[model samples]
Target: MVEAVHTAVAGRVRYRVAGLKRAPELKKLLEFRLSRTPDVTHVSASDLTGTLLVCFNSGNTVEGLAGRIAAIVEEYRSHGGGLAPGDNPGKEAGWLDTVPGLTPAYEAIKGLFALGGEQPREPWHTLTPEEVLARFGTSPDTGLSAGRAREHLTTYGANLLPESQPRSSWEIFFGQFQSLPVALLGAAAGLSLLTGGVVDALLIAGVVVANAFIGYKTESEAEKTIRSLQTQVRPTALVIRDGRMSEISAAEVTLGDLVVLRPGTYVPADARVVAAHHLSVDESALTGESLAVTKTEQPLVGVDLPLGDRRNMAFLGTTVVRGRGSGVVVATGLRTAFGGISTQVREVGETKTPLQGRLDSFSRVIALAVLGVTALVVLLGLLAGEAPRTGSEYARRFTWARAAEL
Candidate 1:
């Protein structure tokens, strides 16, 4: 298995594998294998570092992407074939291949990546209240007709955060063992077990298991907290549909639907203020400022104001602490600022901690020291008349003998 090297904000993933480095033939074989995978936009392998970077559509999950690469690596290790018939490997190089530089250039290209291609965005904040209403195919006097609302809902899907796919408990538990320190410990335990120091091996494995339990428990709690916060967002919304006001589930709210907001209401989507009566929102959920921010319907003059200063917009997850106002929903779900942040959190790659880095270095040093000691012990044992066990084996056997005597 290869380690995930990097992942860009736009869904490009890089994997670093030492086995394929300097092996041009193998690299080409891998590139060919990956090219056939579905949803993979591009594949590139660097001969210098044996790094394979793949770009996929936004819909692809990281786990699925990594599994695909692992499968390809396994295939190369097995049959080890060249490019299949009629497979011109050179044809797969995307525009990214012609570009200079590596990670940075790929990131720039991915930042502009769009799902289903980009759609033009209307500057609703620049328009007047009446103008905004007209553009949405609705009016101030009457909201979207029932039939129109249904069509919008079908187009936009539900206004809700996509639930994360649940990982099996065994997978989560096993993932903890991937750390460098754990790997070293596992090797030590294996060596101990081979020498018959069962107690010592059990103790080392116990530490590993304890560490995994702590990590798993902490992650489970954090997930529960996030779910609680999501539930706090208003579950139901009051919207004017079919020329009449009705209470509906927040998920039923659609674009161009005229939403009704008042004190104690949580905005269901990112919206532009159309009408307000001293509208003030407690945006602390987003801005972290306890004070309520006042909002106005008058077109904001400046384009570059912080979320708190925007004054004429209401974001999802923020509560209407005071006054009353109505805004046309502009963005919802993952399109909202809150939703974008959530997406980033999910896609964000794990960074090595300072201690983890030191541990990695320590692991290398330990590996070298162990190899040297093992070689020296083997040489001395061979020089002696009777064959002797290796250093670790000798230690384990001595411990077992002593325990039996006790």
Candidate 2:
């Protein structure tokens, strides 16, 4: 029994209880329950113990995830079409009404944490490209889902490349020289040189290089700014692990990790403060309000409070200007409010600069003009007798009959 408890807490479990006479029925019931819970990615049943263990991916909120599991347990108990003691099982010690509107799975887990007064931790330091690829089972050579590939590219840049992966600003800058636009520009310059327009060719080459340089610089600066923001804010969060207070890296946090916040430290992740001592945070990044907003440890009156009005919540990337508090980390990368903003920025994409648009329009116009001028020049020269000069000279040299004989 003690071993089972440890297994349940340390990992995950699904089970069915039945008399020895009903063992076959129990197996059938477990199978039916497992099949119904499609979210369970893996399931293993033990005939000896009549226990089923299910594993699921982290796709939904903790509360939702747990609710799904609870539902499965209840369904298994009621599989014989009759109510049993376990059918309407008493609520778990650490369970709450699933957060409204969340998936059953997310609600279940989050509710567990809420009732237990547990919080989430920050993530480990930002994952490198290789680590991310390994986690997702992506290969440098193998193809990936378009959406996933794009996400990886946006996050890691040339680090996705296996060799000569660009890690610094300068390497990234130089990498731009190898793109299709640069190649096209080179072709244009070569054409110009062959046509004996050395000056024009050189000018065109210069423009292409300059444009590449500007684009590289802008991207580099944006990355540097984001890194600077990350560096400047040093947030110390108090975390309880194994029932002991410990100070740890703010980024190496995970969902449901408890955090302690104090005046003057930034909130490292999205959290609901379970305890507060006159807590307040400067949420200018999220709300555009310049003042320090007060917070409380009480359950929020409304579930749908706008981020700015979530008086019981503290968000990632915000400053705690006054008071002390402890909260649970509910979300992290691509999940936190700041992470959401980052995702949105990536989704909107980088627009071409005004100069780039103008240059593109100008180039198209010039190309058409050159083609038209070349045609017009050939036609004019033909009309001026320049094309038939040899024929005319032969005609002057001999009569029609003499030219034919020759």
Candidate 3:
């Protein structure tokens, strides 16, 4: 039930529903339902704040609105289609977590962070080839001069997956303990030890160790496979450097260089097409979509278009499945659209998978619950005069030798 333990108003009314916190689906449902409510000017729900904030028409009473909210919550719970996704979800599994660079989750997480970038940059696809070239201070015919290319190369770094923040064996092992439930388990273990429950503490510690060890082993192997994949041959690209067409390692392709794309060749960097000879790219590797997206050199008119709709631009790492095109490299390396994109390498390392983000959020909820319950249990035990009797008060007649005996 959605009970409002607290309500306050300062233009927007806040309904504090502690139950909604940590439940992403519930938050979404509440926001969706409340947004359509009559006289409501704005509705916002935050899982982090555990509150439903609504700005209704000044004429409507807060109590009346909250009543409707409560009804909506109750009705949904009483209905058949109200269940959150995977209410029958399997046990938590990190065994299948992305190995960093070569998975769909890798792309998804990158897109999430990019879409949430601090300041969404203006779309490059809106500008014509001449404007795009002018913006980068380079030319289509001559490309970047050798000096300018070297300068941009230094600034943007290599056209490669950054090796920054490569987690160590120890880091991976300890990451298992980074969750909230594990933290609660640790606290419970400490309390058990302090209360002279040596056996209990040992058991709790063992569970924590076993969990971490298993996660460590699994993630270790996954990352090891990633490392092996990284060692494979780096692709090469044909580029015009200082007005001379030269073949270079894809990693050597820098910003503003003119890259010639042919069928079967992977797009080495995110580029704005200057010329297209009936180009159609297999963007499946990058977009997880069709093998054929027709490319165009003409400017596309749209606002925040999806990756697939940006026909005027080519993404890094996607393949040219048919025809040929030449583009001016706009962004290389981590800044490319293949995921893990930003203006800097640090942000790339900091980006987490959606699964990881959700898990972390859920863990916070579990930890809070554990803390509250632990405090309550202690309070009740103390009230009942069952304060823990440690070393001095232990008696052979009273104490059980085995934990199971208790």
Candidate 4:
């Protein structure tokens, strides 16, 4: 049932629903019921704020709508409604008490995957430092202790995207043969074998293998170059751990880790600014904004704000060109925006090029032609050659007649 009601804007009334913090499903149920009411143009609910927005039809008023909606909700609850199908309220409180971190994880997951889930891209520009700390379950004074940090690292895994397993040389070589031209070459080799052209078949097979190897070698070399560049650019980070400051490899930084940002230092992970001093970041690498952005510590209101406008968040791989600040690392490795992109690069399946598509069509035509030619050759051979079986049958019959006469 609604705990309170207030006008959020003209023609829009907001209801503070009770028990929404515990029973998130109630929000949807409440929305479902409220939207069905006549003259209600729209209904939207936020479990985070325990509020629902109800818009009335033009010329219609929400003057008495709040009381009416509240009465409907209270009647529904009085009749034992709004419970999840399998839920037993009697045991829910006990389970919540027994489970450590279950409630928080539930809330986090809800915020992460909900319709408007996912923390603001640049929350630093939108959220206060204390709010940031509260959001991540950390403190500004002491930072996360060693034990807690280790637990989070273990739970979330290293703050990085999983490295794709290196493809074996044979795998790379075979992958090149997946193309249309190679398929056509394979068909040609098979036809040669069927026609008793053993040497010719072997020659075509050799060419196909050589071409695969050349493509593999070229790809492998390019990967090697990229790896070398990555090693050369690998950055170090300054972080506060167990209440003391230390410099560590960027890869070691994990979620909830407090990272110290300074001018001329590369951002180690995706983090929100908790403290800043004229903090201006050169985000051109990520946002293409040539001018360094000035950041501040203030809570922002809204959802899904753009990255460039999220002046409070610092992304990994970006350099702090001016000023210095501290940020709580919210994402590491593959979970970071940069890492998300890298994972996409690896997971995206290769698409057929336009040339490959045309070549595939050509290969189909060639295969059909080969089949037609082979059938014609076989027909001609059968017509020209004597029938061995018929000749044998006649010889056997003549032998049998001779034996009987003798």
Candidate 5:
């Protein structure tokens, strides 16, 4: 059995339910609440088991709907009308309180009021579908079909993954020139000078500094480019508050806000259009098509429609190119299509660049060569007749012997 709640502010609907034989009274309470809600225009109730499916028009607001639902739940609890069969062995218990243990259906409803009407903020940092599958050990395509993947990529721009911020200029500057090669060169120079090879030490030190400078420049430039891209792709959205439309940063938007969308505007969140007049949007970000899609104010019947096919809805990061519309936000940040996509993208591991790979290999080769040269020099000197006499008497004896032989 299922009971559904459609919140206007969120533009998303969630379901709650109890099984046919498990919690019949809970289903009855949900039906009673559905009957009392004036905004609920359509309700399909099961005669045998008391399952209720309720739908609200686009004109409803999320806060308004949530308030009404909360009141109904509270009323049922006070009057002992929300008791489910076998909830308690001898006495009646609040069905809403115990619903989480009964099934996953009431979890959404329970979560709605758990924090005293303060909704959970969508996580700004999210992973892409690919990432979710990879992390959970599921097939990459299991929950993310090809069409869904494409939608996510298009809507969120390169998948809904949070970008890594580049290191600050100071960090980059300090980190540059600090490499194994440079360290080794410094060590070699210090050792050579201590052993009375000042000229060789200076030469090695110069080479090390020069190599450090080159590597530092390359790495710094790469970091700057990445930072620039991140700034360029950041999006802003238009929203309506207190009956006035204004532009604001997307991060500031919350659930239940009304966002205004027009040509060239990006949809800031997941929303259901309450007002649309010949509204056409470029959903290619989520749909992977260059063609603009016509949007309507009609209700969507199925939850299975791919984000691209949900004509009644708009998603974050999608552009409005050809029409005008206003929608009530249902999901923001991580709950939106962009957020979901971002979650997936986060799972893809970063791979080393070709240049990086080549440089690593080159560094290894140079290190091996230096070690081999040092080893050969030390080994040859030891093997040849360059051994020093141990004590003064030994040296004097060797000299006398040599002189006598001469």
Candidate 6:
């Protein structure tokens, strides 16, 4: 049983769980659960230590991750799942619903973190180039045939990002009104108009419009950062097709396609390096680290690897700065590492910082309190046979007098 810790260093933490070293099923459950969390990047159990280690994004706290682990432990116990190795833990597989909306496998996140310890040992990165080619049924020397390429194109779709379609100007403009406060203000405006407060309604409506417009303008400015990714693609790439070297638009590059890499070239899709002659690349576009990374056709070991350490793989939107190498396109489109960043940036509104979430909760509480107090005051006024009083000048003077009395 892992005791819950209130604090931990950001990004990485470890918990000691009894019998987990010998209980493979329990270990898998812990790894699968943590791997599904949006902020958690890596999870592994050390059979030697009876400990579960996790690495996550810096945006989340260690306390939250530890709580999740503790919750899993409690839920497993309450459901009569085994905590000891002799408890026949495999029978507890059906109890995974304790964590809402989580899938049993971690394959969805396998692509993003696979470059280093960010991902577990998936097939492509762990396999040699020849082995990868055999699995894809493509030739390392001739690449995919034109007919097979067409079939894979149908299977994988285009080599373009799907989740990150540019927000239209109108979408950006209208999306600004989708927040809770904005909805409440819109309701207030409607109520003001219905009550024959046209001037007051217009003033409130004007404020809403002005606020939305200012937001739209500010977002339009920020939209430029998303456009920067558009510039990262090289537009065209050289590939080996039909046993002959040819140049094609990067978008047409698909799964099983053998993309030739050289100096000053951009990788159009995520690929495994089959051959390399001193290959190095500028991966700053995806990782934000400017150091040029060397490429190789070697498999890396250890659960502590990061994306930057995945030297055997070449990711999309990264530039080849030195030497030459070729990688089999294992993943395409939004499945690439670069596409993962695009997806993250696109859905950032849903992944609120912890402080932002707390502030939003506090705002709702304050709003409800204000509404309840106003309703009580109106009830008291009506019962006393008096009208509900208003006027900011009276409110200000009355508040001061009450404060002095207190």
* Candidate 1 global lDDT: 0.68
- Backbone clashes, candidate 5: 20
lDDT scores in order = 0.68, 0.52, 0.68, 0.66, 0.54, 0.68
lDDT of 2 by residue, 343-370 (tens): 6777786677999788767755655554
Tens-place lDDT per residue, model 3, 1-406, is: 4445444654567777645655555554565556556677666676655667777786677778878778756654554224455763562432113222222212222223212222124578998999878877787888888777666665556566655445888889888887667766676667667767677678877878997899999998887567545433346688887789865557667778889889988788889998999999988877789669999999988878898899989998788988887998877666677646434445444778899899788767765654565557657878999865654233211222222111
Alpha carbon RMSD to native, model 4? 23.3
| Candidate 1 local lDDT, 1-406, one digit each (tens) | 6777686556788888656665555565565556546666566776555677777786676778777777666655554333453454555533334433333312322323232222126656666888777777876767888777666665555577766764566777787777655666676677688877678778777877888999888867765556445433336677887778876656666678888889998799888898999889999889898899888998876566667777778898899988998888877677777888889978985577999788778766765565566566656877885455465666553333222211
Worst 10 residues of 6 by lDDT: 112-121
Ranking by TM-score: 1, 4, 6, 3, 5, 2
- Give the number of colliding residue pairs in candidate 3: 0
TM-score of each: 0.55, 0.41, 0.48, 0.53, 0.43, 0.48
Determine which window of 10 residues in candidate 2 has minimal summed lDDT.
157-166
Instruction: Tell how far residue 261 is off in model 6, in angstroms.
Output: 1.2
Between candidates 1 and 5, the lDDT winner: 1
Candidate 3 ranges beyond 4 A from true positions: 1-148, 154-164, 178-211, 242-244, 285-288, 299-307, 333-406
Compare candidates 3 and 4 on lDDT and give the better one: 3
**Which predicted model would earn the best TM-score?**
1
- In TM-score terms, candidate 3 sits at 0.48
Q: Taking the tens digit of each residue's C-alpha lDDT, what string does model 5 give over 368-398?
A: 6666665565467569965434433333322
RMSD of each: 17.8, 22.7, 21.4, 23.3, 21.2, 21.7
Model 2 regions more than 4 Å off: 1-188, 196-236, 242-244, 353-406
Worst 10 residues of 3 by lDDT: 397-406
